[model samples]
Target: MTSLTSPTSGANRPARLGVQIAPQHAPYEKIRDTLTEVEALGADIAFNWDHFFPLSGDPDGLHFESWTMLAAWAEQTTTIQLGALVNCNSYRNADLQADMARTIDHISGGRFIFGTGAGWFERDYDEYGYEFGTPGSRLNALDDSLNRIEARWGKINPPPVHDIPVLIGGGGEKKTLRIVAQHADIWHSFGDPQVLEHKLGVLGEWCDKVGRDMSEIEISTELKTRTVEQADQLYDLGARLFTLGVSGPAYDLAPATDWLAWRDSKNA
Candidate 1:
């Protein structure tokens, strides 16, 4: 695992907002329109979750694949960086994920963020016929796959248009944080300020052991139920990228609009 700091990580980076368009319980046209709308609303990143079924409401509601939609989103939006909020590593081969990301990177004119995770959803594996291994085994697999993914990116023909930024999601202290300290350009977590503060301390210890600078990994967190004031606590702790999750038929972006204004105010 490489310990070099990512070029994109910095304390001076402006606070940025991302929106995760849940691709469930709605038609693809609805999803497509939501993507464009968020970009026009000035979101810094547009994301979709990798799930085989709806996480809420109906169990068999209308749904779509993640990376495929990301490819479409790449062409649909001209500015917003596109990727799965957290692509399931168990769903695809590591090399294929890298190549697919590179292809989309080209298609989007270098606007891509490779956000991935060890994948915890059991249904996605059971329904898709992937091995529903133990969490430790899955995490170990993720650690190995990331190395291969990075290696594949180097050897692929024509090469990636840019050093595709890697955004990893999870808050596990033992393995996940180690992985982030080694490879991530952006580290996204779902913890509250108290949880994040403690976990980040662990991450710093891991970084010290691996000879990585914790500051070289941009801190990210979800704004699922957080107010700007609540988010301010995280911002004070160094989180620069905030993601809001909008789901289903309506895909309400009013909250995102407010957050975008907050982001602009922070940057200013």
Candidate 2:
């Protein structure tokens, strides 16, 4: 297992805001425009999810593919790092995923973060003709995929312009954290401060067992119904990258503007 500690990930790093523009319930132009807006608003990262169907609201709402849109986003925006908030590892071959990431990295001038995880959307699997295996099987596959992705990054031509950061999403303590200790430069979870503190402890245990420094992996979490003061509690627990998710049809960025203001204050 390779250590993918990012030069930019650490507790001391300035706090940054990420906006996940959900690719559902809207037209592609709206989604693209939202990405542009996020960048203009000073978001450090712009993200989308990798699901075939809507994760909320209308189950049959309009949606788009994750990677292709990311490729286009590479050309559409500059300066802001972008990627799927968490890509489904089972959707494509590991090597292919790595190659595509490298291409997007080049296209974005090295601003792509390879965010991925063991797939969990059963609807996606069932509807897209992918085998919806049990949780353990998907995790095992994710472990294998990470190893392949890292190896492929090494073999690919015109390799990623930078040591592409890998962001692994999920808070499963046993297998997921262990894999995170091995491969991730960033670990994202939806855990509140209390839960995040406990999970960080568990992740520390895994890091020790795997001989990886816990400080090497940056902590990330979502800002769902949490106040900035509440987010401060998470910051106290070592979360540096805070994400705010906005769904489409109307990707209102008012909250993102507020979050970005908070981020500016933190960094200041």
Q: Return the lDDT, model 1, position 254.
A: 95
Off by over 4 Å in 2: 1-10
Give the alpha-carbon lDDT of every model: 0.89, 0.90
Candidate with maximal lDDT? 2
Shift in Å, residue 231, candidate 1: 0.6
Cα-based TM-score, every candidate: 0.95, 0.96
Q: Model 1: which ten-residue window has the lowest total lDDT?
A: 1-10
Residue pairs whose backbone atoms clash in candidate 2: none
Question: lDDT per residue, candidate 2, 1-268, as tens digits?
Answer: 0222222225577899999999999999888888888999899999999999999999998999999999999999989999998999999999999999999999999999999999999999998899999989999999999999999999998899999999999989889999999999999987667777778888888998999988888889999789877788787677899999999799989999888989888888
